[model samples]
Target: MSQNDNNTDQKKSESHALVKSDENGHALTVKGKGRLLALTDSILKSAIASRKANQLAVDDSWMQEIWNWADSFTISEKKIPRNRQMLLGLTELDISGNLLEILPESIGNLTNLTELNLQQNMLSELPESIGNLTNLTKLNLQNNRLSELPESIGNLTNLTELSLRDNRLSELPESIGNLTNLTELSLRDNRLSELPESIGNLTNLTSLDIFGVRLSELPESIGNLTNLTELNLDYNNLSELPESIGQLNNLTRLDLSRNELSKLPESIGNLTNLIELDLSSNNNLSELPESIGNLTNLIVLDLSSNNKLSELPESIGNLTNLTELNLYNNRLNELPESISNLTNLIKLSLHGNKLSKLPENIGHLTNLTELDLWSHNLSELPESIGSLTNLTELNLGYNGLSELPESIGNLTNLTVLDLSNNELSKLPESIGNLTNLDSLSLHGNNLSELPESIGNLTNLIELFLSRNELSKLPESIGNLTNLIELFLSSNKLSELPESIGQLKNLTRLDLRNTMVRELPTSINQNRVKVIL
Candidate 1:
């Protein structure tokens, strides 16, 4: 049987044997035997009914033990009534994962209770008496049917954390502001359309999560939470924020993605302590306030999928501490030369933009580790690009490039280089200098021949040169002993160098649509899978 079933059966056996019919009659045995009272009012009421039926007789001593055991209680998976007497000194109560529909007003009588978990229950409302537990520090009512909290909840002055997530709560009582000591509050996945201005009274709050809701606007008073360090309000319908948000000078992380924000207040720059900001997927936002540059401490910033953003403020370069910046899927036509000021940038994405060219000083970003400029109208890369020696991945595919700078070979750190679907007729012999290259793609080009120097990329694992006018591959191709997949289909080649057979590590080679009539005898002798 399942462990849960065994425990349930054992609990039933223990409850039935609590009062033996022997001469002992309702004996309260606290010996090596099972528990004499293992449940709360749910089972205790059944015990009482049994006693009244003359099946078992309980004395005052037995009743005392029942009351004490109720201090730490549970009514889980049982049908119980709200009128059950409250255990006055109860310190902990767990009625979670139950069918409870209501909490009795007598719960307040348990003034000593410090923690209460009522998650995963059918509770639609809580008794106002709950506020009487002034000593309570933690309360979890998540995954319930509660549409509102009792106004008296503010009376639990000592509460540190309150979670009402995944509930039907539409609004919070103004008295909730009385929770002066609360530090964490989560109301995510609710239909809360607005917050009470009194929410600002929570001066001690450090973390607040109201995401997955349709809150169109936050109360201006929310800025009063000076102690807040993290605020997540994503996936909401918020179109604008109050200027008072700048008051959160202590905030370090802010997420406002997936919102309907069309603009931001200049006060946004006031978050000087902010380290990470996400404004992605907010298609309605066309531009960011210049004040954004004020987040000098920011390390990561995402502004992708803002189609109307035609340009970025030059002040963005002021974020010298930025390590990752994403501006993909926008209508940007040009990047400010100031972008070179982000010397600490490790990754930058400018894909799917309307840019015809990049800033001449683009090469000034020496710390870039990954640069993606796919699907642009660029004609050529600046010679300065060779200065990005730290670049490990570079994507310049689907562009109008016809030639590359010889300096490109200076990026010896490149592991994956994509130059497909371009107008290039030939590559600079300097391409052979990328000894550390792992994947090289030069497909869909006008190339008529590859420089013999191409063979210098001995570390290449994947080489795609399909749809080219090449008549023959440089014999040096055989030098890539580590090559695994090679695509040379749709070429004019009639023969391959005998050295091709030396690539023992090659598993797949494609030569379809080519003029090749026969494979090298050596290739036919190896385990390589040739595809024609």
Candidate 2:
């Protein structure tokens, strides 16, 4: 009886296993059992396939040859693939703006890399292995905290362009001269106090920027780069240039501004091909070499802010091709008549000088577009000034100008005219002929009234008449419909002309300390800010 009961129970258990129940405890049919078995097999196959695909991806990731981790990539050695073939095939790697504080030494394994950009990072030092990138033609390490470079950096002989700007580097490795193929090198805004004499070995260099360095002198070997066309040595402490600099006959532009240079080497005149030269802000520069006249090709020359520069070489006239000449803030009392020979001059600035008069032939520069003679002792301008019909901007403020030449009316193209802080008791009626003037400054003057013809300046957007003796404004003042700013502060104006209300575009009306006690009802107080 026990054997029979055991066999029956085993059979019942098998049957129950083949059936399934719904939430309500239901039994399954044969077809349903078959369907369930097929579904389970399909799920197992998908799981196995997905696992294989994931494994394949992991295996192939190491074959990637290009890596661009700009900004979004996190620095982690474990995340980089370690395959040798992948490293050898990688030709470009950019990790700019990644805030990377440290680069892995293993990066040198990418021996085939031609371009590497690590700009805008926090890196203070580079691995010595960096020199191993002999195939690299371009490398940018700008805006980093590096104070020095590995001497092995000179090993990158193939480098043509390298930027180390905005770093703390105080000196460069002499081995850097090994990059004979370098055409462009930038070391701007670094702490470098001197350049290695070996730098002259880079004869192929055409552009070299060493701006904002502390260099007091350049090596004579620099002249060996006869192929150089541009050299920027601005904001340095250089007091003099090596005479050998004249050997760079190919130079088209040279900047020695903001230095302590007291004089220039006569050999500098040998650079006959120079097109632009800047020597501004050199407080100790007292004179220029007479040989400077040899630069017949010079088009732009800036000698501004050199307080000790009392005179210019007479040979300056040889630069007939000069288009711009800036001599602002010097001690020159007069200009050489030869200056008038520069018919190509487009801009001439002589402001903040002791010049009592300009060359009588200054008017010959008909091509002049801008002339700044402000802050000078000039009491009168040559009538020839009016001959500069092409002039659009003229500054004569902070001067002893008691009168203007009648010929000034001929400058029909003038858009800006500044005559403030002068002894002008009256303005010539011809001043009204400057119909294109957009700004007219007459503040700090003795004008008690404006000429009625002033209304002819319909394009006037700004009119400065503060600190003047203007007791009344002409009715024509309202004719300046485009005027947005009217300065009448510290004036003797006791009342406003009803025509003043015609200035529909006026937004600012300065009347502080004026005699006026109230505004005219015609004025739109809501739109105009009246300063009392």
Candidate 3:
């Protein structure tokens, strides 16, 4: 028609115009035809109306939250909860995989809920509409079946993180001082008894685990939390403590081990940033608070099974950066040479004490590496304990020592040397110069013999000279060869030194009440087990 109808309408407007190809670039993955299929059908109808407006704003923020016990089989029902008032656009709710046992009353219409996760539920009681959430701030009722907990939960008042771990709560709601913006409060394995003075008003708690609760007392307003830093009342039933717990003062790890505490308040040395202090199995403690040497930033101090301690306060050598000092089953007979001022002690446990002697400044600690004076009542030892030399574990078992101080061959970094039930007849041939001895206990000793320099220990492995009074032994104790448990029981040793069949890692060879009636046919006798 006029230029062939405008050249066919300019080739149908260049086939719908949105073209590509400016060089070798070919991503015009031409799907439909020209004009880019009407601009890809108007951009797929505006991306389906922007994905239905983001799923209608996530279903209107989960239908204004609040009590949404979205079920999954948490134990069936107990009903009652329903969305009350416009639930203040409830904050977060999931009533956790439920089986509800109670806790409904429409949680007082979510007073602007903050965060409430009812973990694995089957709740046993709680809803006083949880005192209207009051803007809760993280409250997870972990593994529930709660055995009670609602003094209207002290009206939430902006909680800061409270998890009632594994519940069966025995009692708590002293209006938990109304949450007071808590900060990590877990009642581990609950059965809690007493703890209400409004939980000392939280005072901005900082980690407080009530492990295995049965708590006997603590409400001296727990010194108002004072910003705690790790406080676990382990195995509770506390016998005493309210010295306003030295007002917390930013404590750092305090586990009152198996409680029934026998005493401790010298204002507990005012915490002084304590670092791990566990009063192990309190056994009616016999005493211990010379202001705990003011905690000198303690580092692991566990007074093990307090067996009526008999001594230890020279301000316990002022701790001096103590590193693991557990006084096991005590009744101490001696030790405080101010423990030679600890000298950066490294694991020193005086097991079952009744000590006979030790303070020759016990070789000034020398950065000791595990030294347990087992059973104690020692008969001798202080040759300045052979200058520790970073000893690697040395337990002087059930003492009454017969002899040893040849400056124990300067401990050549001993590797476990437990001189079992002592009365040792003799040993210091410079203890075969240790050579990293690997476990050597002269069990119930009185050794009749054993020194060809014990064939230089050769990294001996578990060689306990059973109930000894040995009649004879040195063939260099058969060159150890990494022996494993070679106890010569009640020895009177009748015979058997064919180099004790050159032990090939003998696994237990106790010549019971020995007069060794036999054994030595190249002693493997089926991987040895000779208990007689």
Candidate 4:
């Protein structure tokens, strides 16, 4: 053989040594050989180091692809690529609000991740390999299309917070109970009909939100979560609660509003630690258990819109710590005298009820800032109302009151007062004593003339006296320099008060259907829009 032929043979031998083939005899390229050698070298180095080093040998091609995708992704004005480094060392990843539809199974290679947020995505399923992330402590998958979670998720025993809210999940895997360290879990706005019994295993849970789910009842196992401090089960189909619910004595806040519940379990009283309780909008609820009085620590209690609620248990007076009490739209005709014991109440709303009179001791609520008794059968108000010196807002509209008590002026702190649609023919001069008033509505009444004291409300921004029988406005009305809107429509006024020109801040003066035919030159010169 010639020298050239010998050189060619040597090169062929080198090439053959670098490449290999399968049993089928298809040759592997030199590039493939290089990759294989690199993988082998990594594995050998990992074996020589420690078990944790084995993770460093994982194929990083998948991560490289993810990095490439992240290059173009943005969330909340943050670029995900900015956090990237060597893939194996990644401990936290946030790709939320990216509209991502798939999560590659190779993601499990990121075993070092402790926090993963994929919320507000379109992902329909998670890879079972997710279980490989045993170090994960927080996982957020809210607002996704997930119909179910992989059982392997239970392997994340270190997880403390998991939010699967706004998903399509109808059921959870029993393995979920394995996450014993979980402290907060949110499944709000999902399609879940019931929770797995295994949920009780999460005794470390401090907060659990299952709002807007279709659950007709909660599992008895839920009672096992004695450490829970906040539990929200609003907007469900629950008609009754399991007695086991009383076991969660640590709960500080409980929301059971907008459900089909007709009665609450008497055991509910056991949650004495509760600071807020909402049981509103349960149309079937006619009476509350006397045990409700046991929640003495409550600061807010909402029992509104229960149409059949005709009376409250006198025990309600036991919640003296309450600051807000909403009992609007009920069938109650009279309030229990015990209600006066809620001396700490700041807001009391009883509108849309059949109440004809208020307790004479209502003045006991010295801290009251707002009182609403609209749409009731009240023909008169108790003189004791004058004692609510701290009152800022008072609504007695749509009542049968023919006159206000002369002591009404005692509410000097009043900023808004609505007494519309009443039988009042005249307002007490005391009405003017509310000098702090910014808005006063007295329309839809039988008033024939103005109270000169009305002019004393110099702070008034809006004065509504429409749909009344007023024949003339007091000249003192011009003293309201801060008035922005003056509604005098459907009244018998024949002409504008020359003092009206003094309202420099007036923007709208509605005089439609009034006897006035000409505009005040002062109003014509200003920017006021007069609606005739």
Which residue pairs overlap in candidate 2's backbone?
none
Q: Over the stretch 1-532, how does candidate 2's per-residue lDDT look in tens digits? A: 6999999987775565445454357764434456778856875897799899997665344333223331235534333434445555778877788788876565665788899999999999998989989999999999999999998899999999999999999999999999999999999999998999999999999999999979988999999999999999999999999999999999999999999999999999999999999999999999999999999999999999999999988999999999999999999988988898999999999999998887779999999999999999889889999999999999999998888888989999999999999999988889899999999999999999888999999999999999989899999999999999999999999999999999999999999999899888989999999999
lDDT for each of the candidates?
0.87, 0.90, 0.80, 0.91
The full ranking of all candidates by TM-score, starting with the best, is: 4, 2, 1, 3
* Pairs in clash, predicted candidate 1: none
Q: Report lDDT (Cα) of residue 16, candidate 1.
A: 58
Best-to-worst ranking by lDDT: 4, 2, 1, 3
Scanning candidate 2 in windows of ten residues, the lowest lDDT window is 62-71
Candidate 4, residues 246-353, lDDT tens digits: the string is 999999999999999999999999999999999999999999999999999999999999989999999999999999999999999999999999999999999999
Over 203-236, each residue of candidate 3 has an lDDT whose tens digit, in order, gives: 9989989988788888898898989899999898
- What lDDT does candidate 4 reach at residue 497? 80
* Segments of candidate 2 deviating more than 4 angstroms: 1-85
List where candidate 4 sits over 4 angstroms from the true fold. Answer: 1-85
Q: Estimate each model's TM-score.
A: 0.80, 0.84, 0.34, 0.87
- Residue-pair clashes, model 2: 0
Worst 10 residues of 1 by lDDT: 76-85
- Badly placed stretches (over 4 Å) of model 1 are 1-111, 117-129, 143-145, 524-526
